[model samples]
Target: MDSSPHKLYHVHGIDSRQFLEHYFSDEPDMAFGDDLLKFPIDSLRQLFTVGHIKGDILIDLSLGCFIHHLYSASEFFKNIIVLKANNRCIMELKRWVDERTGAFYWGHASTFLQEKEGYSDQFGDKEGKVRSAIQHVVKYDPEKENMTDPLVLPPADCVIIATLLDVISKDQDDYIRYLRKFCGLLKPGGHLLLIGCLDTTYFTVGKDKFHVFTYDESFTRKALVREGFIIDYCNVKERTAVSDLVDYKGVIFIAAHKEK
Candidate 1:
């Protein structure tokens, strides 16, 4: 039997607005709102508050233009470097940073984070803080030996990748290879915070389905260990919301550090 028609994120271009509306929107009915937004934001809030992940530079290589987690991250890391797989994503993110017209509104996300952290107001400044903390937004080539060719970034103190690997990786080997590349971006003992799904196969954006590598929690731990990372924290949230856009069994948050 033929599988559903779909596109590979690494090859096919994405519609940034459609992608955000489908997966990252704050609408209560959106299937992935909790899994993609609230879960990671909560986890990052705790992790950053514990005082272990702070640094001068934090590299963000997440799946799309989402920045909910960065509101918490900006408070800890002085400089944020965003790396994207395509220029479209880069431009979309830049639009938000520059406060350009038609930029996707993330106020709902900021409000969500603030409420959780016991802040009642000042929602207006959330974007400003993230924009100021964001030092650079650059494109990266995952196929290149140096993901950021011609722009050698100093090894970061921390790297946060959310829902990116499973979409970009085709197989277990590809997962390991990309994990190694992510490791290369961190300094010795630098922390790596990864957020993605477990046992997922596909996710839809707009009208096209996109591939998501199927892997469970154990495989992820083994992959990180093999890539020279010492796992420090891991959390998994079973599928709670219902949706046909993606068939993910659960969401996962993992924190690890490169072997010093």
Candidate 2:
């Protein structure tokens, strides 16, 4: 089936005028268009300005909408590293990133890089070896296992970016610990960009069920502090309500500098 056309909307809670003024002034082309989800892209643009991100190493945690943003700004990254707890996202990102010119790596958060089923689809023609080109693919369940040691990968001299991975309010402690481990993946003074789903309900993808973790700015701020990151900037915006559909509520974006 053809992929659903990307849609954009202004989520409810945020000040749309201020958000547009702060981030989308130039009217950049968004992967999901101008309406559906506006907070993430705008926040990203602002974060990119706080420090030097061009030619930096970006570690993207969530693969759905976040991947689109990374691809949208492909020219700026030196290497893009993607980690997804979800198998589908990992596969999708690997395919999308491989097609681009920059270096791309994919795997689970707890594990480094290991191949798994449903990772690659059968292709009639082989332009490049997508499977073989993968340097590392580790396998580990974030909830069940702990990443005792950081996965060894290529060194990144610049920033590390991740989003939509940690914001489950109920799992606050666990999420904070996870965030620390994620920070360890980056170099000291490296920038960490994060986008998280705020108040929302349980949603299902295939057989997997995801529960919501309602989070506000204060909670996130404290978590960042505990994780040893200096808050560069943060913004929370409510996702515009879609009639008759499950309400996503809102999302939060944070750009923090890893303390040296």
Candidate 3:
């Protein structure tokens, strides 16, 4: 249990190297060309192959940098459903994806499309025909959130992929409950792909702030098992040189499939 900061940092560096090797290696042929985009798509590819995903509804719970990667690789996906708390991220994703595949975009603040009608006014001053492909945007509150709420979702046939699941309290029990609620969003045998800080303190995104629940592989795996997901495969990768301004250093990649 050597928790010395220097020792931990060194270990983190080594783990990060290993992760880069596995993610960047060309031999696997599944390697994503960009370093930033590799892990999410690679993990998704693994899940798709292992779980036999095809022509299935895919949902991204939070739209971050990974959302772009998802859209770029959308040809391989059956249908893309994206969810985000930020209006700007949703709009950007919508604009980008619509330019490529005519896929719609939705956010918590603006409705690009509601039902069959298109809300072109919502996307003011944008070029190109606002495709019916764009969907409604509604307000999302992670606190007191449930998967069963009709107003909060699209359909049950969606695979839930969340880039960050840090809304719950840090206690293990609370974390388990949050994951259960996330899983409840999908249909039976659907999959859940989660990416977040494994055992870290806090993360800063612009001026916004967030904290991790200090999770490890064993704790997360057990929680998923309790939530009715079979542990298909799990990989933990560390991030080194995260920032020059701060000494921050922990990140993990986790992928799991929902069981019937």
- Kindly list the per-residue Cα lDDT of model 1 for residues 5-108, writing each as its tens digit: 66888789688888999888767677777777888889999888899889899999988788888999999889999999888899999999999999998988
TM-score of each model, paired residue for residue: 0.96, 0.61, 0.61
lDDT by residue (tens digit), candidate 3, 1-260: 12332222111112322322333333334232332344444555455544455444556565242342342223334556555554544554555546655323322112212211243444432222222222433334445555323565644454544434643335677677656766677777776667655565543333223444566667777777877778656776555533422223444456566767
- Backbone steric clashes in candidate 2, count: 19
Stretches off by above 4 angstroms in model 3 are 1-36, 49-51, 63-65, 69-73, 98-138, 144-158, 167-169, 244-250
TM-score of 3: 0.61
Error in Å for residue 96 of model 1: 0.4
Best by lDDT: 1
Higher-TM-score candidate of 2 and 3 = 3
Worst 10 residues of 3 by lDDT: 5-14
Score each candidate by Cα lDDT: 0.88, 0.46, 0.46
Task: Order the numbered candidates by lDDT, best leading.
Answer: 1, 3, 2
Better of 1 and 2 by lDDT: 1
Order the candidates by TM-score, highest first — what do you get? 1, 3, 2
The numbered model that scores best in TM-score is: 1
Point out where model 2 deviates above 4 Å: 1-37, 49-51, 63-66, 98-140, 143-151, 154-163, 167-170, 206-209, 243-246
Residue 49 in candidate 2 has what lDDT? 47
